[model samples]
Target chain A: MQTIQTIIGYLYYAIAAVIGIVIVANFVRSRDVRKMLLYAIVLSPFVLRVLRVK
Target chain B: MADSKGNSLVIKIVVVALWLALIIPGGRQLAAHRNYEEAVVLGPGVTEVKKLSDWAPYVANTPNDCSIYVLDSGVPGGSMLVIGGTHPEEPAGVLSAVTIVENVVPTTGKIYVAVRANRSASTVTRPGDAYPQFFNINTDFGKRTFRMGDRWSNPLDSWPDPEVYVHYPSKQLLAYMDVRNLNRTWPGRPDGMITERTTRAFIDMIKAENIDIFVDNHEAELEYSVISTIVAHQAAADVAAMASMMLSAGEFNMGMEFSPTLLHGLSHREVGDHTDAYAFEIEVPEPFLDRVRGITDEALLLEGKDEFVMRAGQAGLLYEKIDENGWNIHERVGRTNSTIDMIVQMFAMFYPDKPITYESLPMRNDIVANGLGHYLLDPAQAEADRVVYE
Candidate 1:
């Protein structure tokens, strides 16, 4: 059960990471950056996870 | 003036006035919590004081930034960190940290104490549950009052918990409200919410200071299976085993358990997994936390007695022992202080070069006999520079 839960947990983070990448990409493609800061806040947890800070 | 239209307009004004009168007083009382601060007197052993922002810039100017009281003995030795008020509802942890800062004098190593790790959480109370806004302890100087707090950080500071709170890195699903629970947000993110940022600041401080052992103080409900035990990481098993054994044999009865490998976001789990520092979480019983508790007021919080909880114990539902004597706040705080001392003592046996040594701290027996208020120093007598407000 622990292994199964871990697998699902990883999947969840992966999906979140994909969403975060898309947000950054949208900011880069669009030149309008008013909401970029809020978008960055949404991506922080996932980015920190990938960097192994958490 | 006596026309129907005039009468209707007058009635409307009177209704609005009544509504404002009813709402303004209650709103003012709740808002006053933000201004409430508990004074902490610097003990003789304290060498320096730093804010959480000194380590993490992201937490600067935020409500979660907390005071880190450092008691250095000059002689080089090991270091230990003690954090309190991770869940502000657990008053024992907060009181224990304050007692350490106000009385303890280390002789060999250094100690870092944070009286309220989640300062934002301490600014709100569960008034819906009939919790008192503040609790007072009778001291030699006068009554020392402390703000009663909730388990989660105030929504004002960290608003809008996620619908399905996911643990960072692990992504483990948790209760939505737990997003603000400092205890469940260990080793957090630099750009995360306020509670997470507070934890991230703490992790940076721990690694930068080269902390040997990290201790997180907490109080658990009597019904919780983990009560009266020291939850240690795998790396600290040997130290925890000896400490618990030594304490149980002569002093208070204590047990040790290893952190569950799968439990994410817990200090005992994440701190150990993320850093070289061994993590240990101490749990003392607080009857006021029990689901079957009575009154749910300041008296029940301090006295730790409730007929409902006793009844639950009688039915063989509680994991810890209970009786008419009841576990009071003094006993809870003393247990935390003594347990940390025991852990440091056992750690010294294994690593003498980095021995963590401290003296003049109130032990379980001392607090039980003298009461928790005996150790609280008078804020007025304290030098302005030596005092910090939580």
Candidate 2:
């Protein structure tokens, strides 16, 4: 059960990574300043999580 | 077209800079709080300090493997276990346990105090709620700081909360986040989540050590009906009722209630049902937790004063009364300490054979007078070996 929990935890990180990648891709290609600002705001959590800061 | 491209590039740079500006300090503060450790000075009463993993190995190498300070008088009587930090947001609960660890000397039987019963919960604060990462109490020596934690275990420790929490053994469905709540995971299973495993570890210790009385300390918002009360399991109802009566009649206003039979996960219910020990939970008022609270800062957390909460009281929407004085930390901790002292006395009175007695615990009047910090010993003055970090 512990092992399963650990696996699920990693799965969550993987999901977050995928979401981060999608957000980054959109952030890079989008030309709208407002949308870019929104993407950056949304992407901050992913950045922090990746850095293991929070 | 060139101007448009340059403008887009500038906007992107600004966006990136803004992201950095936000995450840099925010992330650093969170990280610092996560890693911060509070110091505990082992008083003369502390005979030995054992890890929770000593009783239950499932919690070994985990964040919830908290310290259990054993204060044994060596006299044959009864044993009691008092645990705090079950809901880490309740500072009074944690401080009350710390007071016990640093002051109380057992005269009969034994006393086991866990200042951080759910150590994993203490590692994080509620960012959405704007909870402070730490709070300091002005001690005689200087200041003693402690982590201001949340109600649930850190997501880093227990990740991917289920959509709905199905409590083990009882199969009662609860809110998803309660799976990480220590109070909601009583008599917990070893193979469960970190909080569940933490409670299970404590239960194992209780059984191993033959604890006769079990006390779980907590503080509730004025909006919560359980404030300034003792919720006792049926097994402990008599002692709790007597203690409440004595306290209300003499020291202060303290009510008593029985733990609902249907409440499957609560300490007052599960601990009594699962173990031989009588279980009781004490709750004091905390204005900081009120939905009608004002500024969410360390001052409100410790001072427990909020005009909004007082206004709520004026509207008669609160179970406990709040005034300009509010429910300060010293009062809350003092109330908790006094309640525990009353419970001990009542337990001893009821069961003469299993008597648990202790001395030097600052009572309600003493704490309300001199302040909570007066009881806290200075680690700097203590020997190097006498201090322990929680």
The most accurate candidate by lDDT is 2
**Which CAPRI quality tier does the interface of model 2 achieve?**
medium
> Each model: TM-score of chain B?
0.97, 0.98
Worst 10 residues of 2 chain A by lDDT: A45-54
Candidate 2, DockQ to 2 decimals?
Answer: 0.77
**TM-score of chain A for the candidates in order shown:** 0.67, 0.92
Q: Candidate 2 on A1-54: residue-level lDDT in tens?
A: 878988998898888889999999999999998899999989888777766666
lDDT of 1 by residue, B1-390 (tens): 468656544554554355456445655677676568788899988889999999998888888889999999987899999999998899999999999999989888789999999999998887778988899988888889898898998865664467888888788998898879997888788877778778888899999999998999999998899989999999999999999999899888889999999888888888888887879999999999999988888889999888999999999999998898788999999999999989998898987889877788999999999998999999999999998888
Per-candidate clashes come to 0, 0
The Cα error of candidate 2 at residue A41, in Å, is 0.7
Q: In model 2, which residue pairs have backbone atoms overlapping below 3 Å?
A: none
Model 2's chain B TM-score?
0.98
